[model samples]
Target: MKRREIVEKKKAISEIIKAASAPEKDHLCLFSQFRHYQYKGHSFYLKSGRGDKLSSILKHHIQNILKINMEKVYGSEWPSEEKSKRKEMVSPEARYIFIYETANSDPNQMSESVGGRGSQTVCANDTETIVGFVHFRFTLEEEVPVLYVYELQLEPHVQGKGLGNFLMQLIELIACENRMSAVVLTVQKENLLAMNFYLSKLRYTISSISPSRVNQLTGPEKSYEILCKVFGVEAKAVLEVIFSIANSAY
Candidate 1:
């Protein structure tokens, strides 16, 4: 082969290596940009995680957020006992909470009840405080990878600002990057606002519904719906755009 042709071939290989090794700029961009929407003087910022101090400020306000939804749906305070039991059930398979401390801890040293693969926590910045959080868990089902939105909550003061929709879009992007076939989540039927948010705006389809018969004997049986969305086509479309941009740069 001619020397010039050989040199050009080496350069093309180098470009491919550079693209594969370095993280995409879009990943960082998503984490940094917040689609701003305001209510009164308060502004909202949706992003993944936050500094330790900011997370601390939002911890106490979580209950206030939980209480608002609980009251509206059940006409009573969220039952601490029931919440504990539910946490205990899932603890065997995954840690219920995700934060710096939990993430930094050694998996072997942690209790069997805590920790799971691909679990992360994200915070929503509201003015000077962190007003909400979302917990994500990724798992493989029947050899196909899927991302699960285990939990999402916003402080009572920050609701109705369109932050939830923004966060959902971010989750979808992350799932696409990870090559997940679909995103799945379970929500209580009583939480009508959440039900509507997932179904109407996010385009999630209900896959199943299970009612708690055990709880029915004691009081009310809470029904839960499982929802999922396939992302194969969407992810391919996004990757095509990224590849086109990289090719243009070369």
Candidate 2:
């Protein structure tokens, strides 16, 4: 499809998301751009992962970004082996959001690069530079169908700038659309930034099923917490106390 059509589609998606977002979450939509982001000197478009090449690159990034935390929690070289075993992660089955920088334009042809939002068929396999990704799956988390964010990693340059918030809002929107119960993910306890980002920044609460809440003291600690944001009243009611309800609100 033409670039114009893709832009219009993304705008429609963005507006749908904006309308679905609650009043408290309106802050995440402060920026006009949703899939496209303006960085140091690049207009990065958010794309989808496809094919072996994009899958390989996605694994490279997952290992590259999380290697440090993996070593700290799971031992050195853990990510190297894990990444290969999990290549299916970037497959079409899972929802993968990729951010890429627009390559230098043909000066003779097009002078200034146009606004870069993700087109309907924006494939990382054919993109210029893959900067980051947010991969998620719709799955049963503690028996409730939830949008489980498997991985979110950005290049050092793209870490800030409200891109993460925008993507998370997208996650919630996806959950609402698919009738998912909530948004959920696991974060390494050692990764303070991730823990804080989900807990403090995004307002996700420690899941009742999280290892930390399950076995407070001597539980075989995998050093991670499952965090979540629930949608339905019944799900939240059940999840709100799944950890503390039976345990006296520990």
Candidate 3:
């Protein structure tokens, strides 16, 4: 198919969402080999999951990880930022790949129980040890289908390992498999480590839609920047190129 046609078809966000969420039997089957990863004497497994199916315990785990890692970055806005993060994490459209350490761990014990807002049936017996998680979703950006990574939080103990890079590679593969135009994510300017990781290590460009690129004056006022790694000509044109300047921010 022509690049224009692909971009035209993806204009319908519903279709992209449907295609991405349809693979229910084995969501990560296309990238099965990535499910297992080892680095720095640490072994871990990635489990595909949905936001709506997150157990109360898993929700707690995600919250704790985000706090420990992002509170300093968000500073005084941490409270409101955390609230937004919680809501986004439970959206039905959100998808996740949870990472768990696999040393002497029973496969059966790593089950996820379904729970969400107002879910009173909390599973106190849950004991899965999650070291990190990648939250993402299929969404429309500049009228093109793309995968937006909402969060990539890891425990302090696991920060220096190559796990972050490996997970991003898997995310890119998933984006390609789903015919996504690009892999997009936002990074706080204050978080220099994360900014360097995406911009320098991953080579993701500062998207044209990013606040910084949108307007040279007010752009610097924004706290974060949107970055993307585009896949095709259509994606590059719509997401990476700056055709005209307008009063907008992404």
Candidate 1 per-residue lDDT, tens place, 139-238, comes to 6533345666766767665678766776777777766665566777777776777877887777676542212322335423455656667767642332
Alpha-carbon runs more than 4 Å astray in model 3: 1-13, 23-25, 105-127, 242-250
**TM-scores of all models?**
0.52, 0.67, 0.83
lDDT of 1 at 86: 38
Tens digits of lDDT, candidate 3, 1-250: 6998867665666676678866352356666577667775677777777888888989999889999999999899999999999999998888988887766333334444454321121123323668899999988888888999999999999888899999999999999888788999999888988988887788888898998788879998999989899999988988894554332232
**10 residues in a row with least lDDT, candidate 2:** 21-30
Instruction: Write down the RMSD of all candidates, one decimal each.
Output: 15.5, 11.1, 6.5
Q: What is the descending lDDT order?
A: 3, 2, 1
| Each model's lDDT | 0.49, 0.61, 0.80
**How many Å off is the CA of 209 in candidate 2?**
0.7
After superposing candidate 2 on the true structure, give the runs of residues whose Cα lies further than 4 Å from its correct spot: 1-33, 39-41, 50-74, 77-92, 103-128, 241-250
